[model samples]
Target: MEISRSLAISSWIAMAIVLSIAPAGCFYLPGVAPADFQKKDPLMVKVNKLTSIKTQLPYSYYSLPYCKPTTIIDSAENLGEVLRGDRIENSPYVFEMREPEMCHIVCKITLNEKEVKDLKEKIEDEYRVNMILDNLPLVVPIKRLDQESSTFYQHGFYVGAKDQYSESKDAKYFINNHLSFLVKYHKDVEMDLARIVGFEVKPFSVKHDYEGEWMEGRTRLTTCDPHAKQTVLSSDSPQEVEDKKDIIFTYDIEFQESDVKWASRWDTYLLMNDDQIHWFSIVNSVMIVLFLSGMVAMIMLRTLYRDISKYNQLETQEEAQEETGWKLVHGDVFRPPANSDLLCVYVGTGVQFFGMLLVTMVFAVLGFLSPSNRGGLMTAMLLLWVFMGIFAGYSSSRLYKMFKGSEWKKITLRTAFVFPATVFVIFFVLNALIWRQKSSGAVPFTTMFALVLLWFCISVPLVFVGSYIGFKKPALEDPVKTNKIPRQIPEQAWYMNPIFSILIGGILPFGAVFIELFFILTSIWLNQFYYIFGFLFLVFIILIVTCAEITIVLCYFQLCSEDYLWWWRSYMTSGSSALYLFLYATFYFFTKLEITKPVSGILYFGYMFIASYAFFVLTGTIGFYACFWFTRLIYSSVKID
Candidate 1:
């Protein structure tokens, strides 16, 4: 069969374009800034020190009072006057967007009439009252009232509880009132002082906020008794009364800003490193370059040596008498094996599938579709599958025809059904298991039905069309006539065995992904987030290179060993990467996963099998096509008589 040079050149050009453009698109797209570009800002609030103090009260307690230097108020004279048990009235200035109005602080000394009379007499005699209020509960208004409407209700007052978890009925009442205020008066009031204040007053605890408004209506207090010469501080201020009225307590308030940025939304460590992309790209590029260089060097050296030796031995009698190298095996090239017609069809379908895959990847590398296009890769693959079904049916039919098989319809049916049927059965079983587990990750029933419908309705028709086109075309004439008698089988070495080579071919590719598999497994099982795009891309490229090189190497060895049954072997040899992938996944489950249960295990393996199948097909195609080209090139160059 003649290969169209134009077609080959066009395919090459397409591949080049895809490779150049796809990665560029990823870089040029508009998206979230790279991690390196993001800058962290300082935190908003700062608390210098906090201390816990044991009070005379029943429970353990703590108090935290912070200070900020400011020149807003010139003197402490007004504050001192208010502290002397006098009625002080001041207009409240609006703080934190709340309307400030006239508020009165009436210092009330609590005492019975008799106690007050005695205290007054004592104070008059001493000229100073040594007794001072201690352990007073401070009540601060967190809201304001305007006209007939209550613009905002008092959120709550912070009261020092006996202990961190200690609950007072009064505190609960205040909290309930605060909840009511938050619900009724303001749509935006969502702060919880009781919850936050405990943390605030804890010794060595730090507090920071972006907005200063969170600190409104919050205060800390210290109490002193002149007679005892003792200073006591409480998270809650001592309660004071004046003329049978409750007085609002005041404390020194301070404010400051802090330096720290809020944490990022995507906290995965793998994603934060910007250098990973460049590193991965460089590694993959190096691997590819090394692979290509080695392959080319091997080809050129082997070809040159063989050609020179053949030229020198042109007139040798032994060389002339011996059957031509590749020509001797031509008789078995297209020969059909007994009871293997179905195998032939499936193998042929695989070949067609492989061809399409190669073309698609070539295009992908040239930039037709890359990660930048979102679902472009999937869409491209799906389209290629549909279009390539024609080749699949055609190749199988033509091969079956060459085998002198009369059951063309059977061959066609098998060609159409084999791959799709295998896929459907695997998928359906997996889906059933997923359904039983009630896993949301499972494909929906409708999607499963749609897939079946697509297989029967869409894929079948395409296969028929492909088969028709294939049958109408002339059969590919074998380069040499087939012999009626089968050739004798030759002895093989241990390393020359197909199984060994195929197994070996799978190793390098799997080795490339072993490290990557750890991260992917962690993401899947531990629910850890991973965004190692650069590393993934690098591993992907390495996998492809390893598969291709290993397959080519194995094909060469098999050829040298006089194993001409490379058609299927080439596919399976590279396809072995899937087995390695499966084994890796299995290992990951046992060693890396914490999952328990038969269903989860089954489900994991089931999905893994499907992925493995796809991967097998992809790598199998790469190996087969590469081997096919190498075989054709070597055979065509050799002298055949």
Candidate 2:
């Protein structure tokens, strides 16, 4: 038996090792296939969404009438990509490896009133054009003054500049029709191949006078000749947005060989912080944990130990009657609270959220869901949430049985649909709002249907299976027996009041993570990259500890006050952090964000509401479990007979 157990443990450890390292190899982005290229190979440049910080909305590249390929083919998008408003499509711009071209004309087209209006609105909104080449995003490089090296980059360039103050009433819109692209490649000396490490663009607007007529197959431009170099002019003519204005799209390509290898290519794109802010956040969280740790230590070692010792030593019935505090309510401490059904559902949903977040963070820390993988992070989160339905079912069903509830199937159904249904309704409404605006941010019907299918077919069935297994198992053995009649609690102090205490309980947990939360919000609302998974994972652990300790501390006080309503209070104490989170989000909106439109404001608040709800579930569950374990251990250690 010992040998078999040892072998089983060894096998499990080996399997875990494999699982941890498996996703590292799949870190590359899914849409693009070519990681390295040989000489003379054709390279494709795909256009992505046009994003804006001022508007905080993303529009498809083809939505505007600049130029298009003969056949527009959209790159395959994952579920996360579809939800995130990524619309990647093929473009007329193409390039050759190790080949440079001078001033090439892509296409020319005449714009009508509607197209002009759309372009002007986007330009005014400060939308930037995004493009991708070999899974590397295109950036506009800023030249340095001293070394003449391109170190800083704007991820994407503006579609055009709007001169609101200029005297050029000729047109407020000066579209950036000319692009100069510089591709940096790293040579693989052993394989005799090259990998594209950088894709940079310099955009400009110029009114060019062409020589030949623009046709479907034949085109010529004297201003942008292949032989001579054409540079950006100090004074260029504006491309007006009047009724029949023609826009010519042109580009120049140059290749530069670099010493940086392919593996470290993304080092340029990842946001390198000063580290002082992150360290401060960590240190602040650690201080909260240490304070809570000291308080808990005193409670367990000095206070609770003394109370239990006195109660156990008492032999006379009169001596037992003289006992006070938590020992007096041993019989009523395990009594189930009212509205236990809702508590069960919340706990179960929290379990599901917990499992999903834990797995997602683990995968992220292993570098599987990095920025290189585009939408892989959200894709993994959704799939993990779906699969974790089993845990939700088991947790809720077990708790329901522990409460002596008989209707297992009803609880399971509620567990499967409650949180997801609420979120789905809110999401559908938001999608409808976006659809009215005709934005690509709205999820397509097919994708929405797929989400529904996953919920009903996969998640619901797994929840049912887990509920069945949980119901068949025996109910959890309580450390103390419940009394027939509930104990009437005396009036509590203002500090122990439910509302005040719950709110106070949440502050420490929020303080632990509010700093990191700013970066997360910025990465989402602003068009910036965030790759601080290690720091994020650490903050998450601290938040968990903070939530758990705060809840336990508060639960001890509540029980000591002879209040047996510990079940929901424990959940609420930690769950209340969401209130602070939402409030912080509101503060962030009024102060940080530039969203002016009513619809945009609605969208931001709507999404933040959902995020806060999930946080409530996640944190509330942590507190509940921590209090539960604390109560059981303290109650069990005492001689309750």
Candidate 3:
């Protein structure tokens, strides 16, 4: 116990030291807190990527032949931003606090044949141009009467729509060159200070006839003039994207003082998806699972107590010989199973994932990872996983030592590389697919190099150090001694068969969290924000409980069936949830998603496979430890000689 406590303390200190040395680019001091602004403060607008639900792809905003600055400098991004395909950069659009503009020309560009082709393809994919103003993403509010909420937002507006008003042999595409911006702000009652709270835009397609060539910030439009006692209205015949044709980009800005305070500005955006969650159904389902698990636990404990008492009150040694069932397998139970090294490796890897997820979720719940901090969640997950390699090494090496294995280094290497290697291979293939599509979703070579560097330099060294410490310590004593010859197992019931039993055991644990899984998947595939970490944390705890309980129940039954080979079986019993999870992902792709492109389909399954595999490791580790504890406690309580 003293050694274990010391190792844990050492791990914490090492983690803290490394984190303090890491960059703080992914965080804001007070994310979601108000940033005060003086009157007429210039608000620099930025452009993100062009997103499309149809293709499930995000292309750089400048990827299409759109208006651009003289030199398009890339925004500084963290590792997570690169991985998530975020390409943020400065745009020509600008605004000021408590100021408005009408019929402002951004740029005029002629569309060549190739540029026209690209634009049409984007429209075919139903792409929306995403823009950012004052760190707030521009959203187009869509009113709905289908649910309790009257309005939800579409993240960005479509570049153009085709063949809606006319049915020509060749689709006539109209581009949305006219943007009507609505900037919402909160004004301080005591002073003239104000803070930009919301940025929304209503996109339109307007064909403008200007008098002369205009330069940005200096030119005004005569077709839709602000001084003519009127402002621009979208033309009945909007600008059409055509080959060898010129198009003009224009915008209008309007400022409105909102009643909402600066601090509560994010309330509206968070509430946009309130209709997405069905609370009563989720709560009701979770309660049923909890109640059933409790009842099973109560009955199992009572039965175990009665059985132990009866077996212990033996009159003589002859009575002990006649005893059968779980007691009969006592000698073999403590014996190391075949291929115990593999089990240790898996359990250790699981420990690493478990630690990373636990810490990441805790931070998210405490508001350290707000949506305001773009890419913060993914960054935290990656960094936490890398730093947690120490725990993985320690756990696997310690387990290998207990299994009486001599090759501690081999086990440590497997723990450090095997799972990550598999994930990387899958990710690489999917990234290759995205690269072929020429989308921003493809991770850059430099970012990939950084990932490799982190794994090798920081994570590997930590693992080696942890393994050396863990392997040097004394191995834990087993509760029961193994016999020279293992006990023969009796014929087990069909339900106790490893394959059937493991799969069945997974059902309950999966049932505990499948509802929550829907929301998580929606957030990822639908490109929406998921900030309900508090509820998510609760579901995480519930999942842990379900996995532990189900595995313990199954282990007890296996032992009772006179089967002592419970090592691998116990891990798989809970880990089978991964299979179900992957299947559900496939189902979602077919039923919920409309991904037609083959590459997009491949990318979806590829990433989901990685996610499911991680889940397998995490839940599998939970079950293994729970079963280990149960066996130790039960065997220790019994009168074994």
Any idea what lDDT model 2 has?
A: 0.85
Q: For candidate 3, lDDT tens digit of each residue in 389-483?
A: 88888899999999998888898898889899999999999998999999999999988998999899978877787788889989988888889
lDDT string, candidate 2, 200-235, tens digits: 999988776666666744666656666655453433
What is the TM-score (0 to 1) of candidate 3? 0.94
Write candidate 1's Cα lDDT for 606-637 as tens digits: 76887788777767766766665665555555
TM-score of each: 0.52, 0.93, 0.94
lDDT per model, in order? Answer: 0.46, 0.85, 0.82
When 2 and 3 are scored with TM-score, the better candidate is: 3
lDDT of 1: 0.46
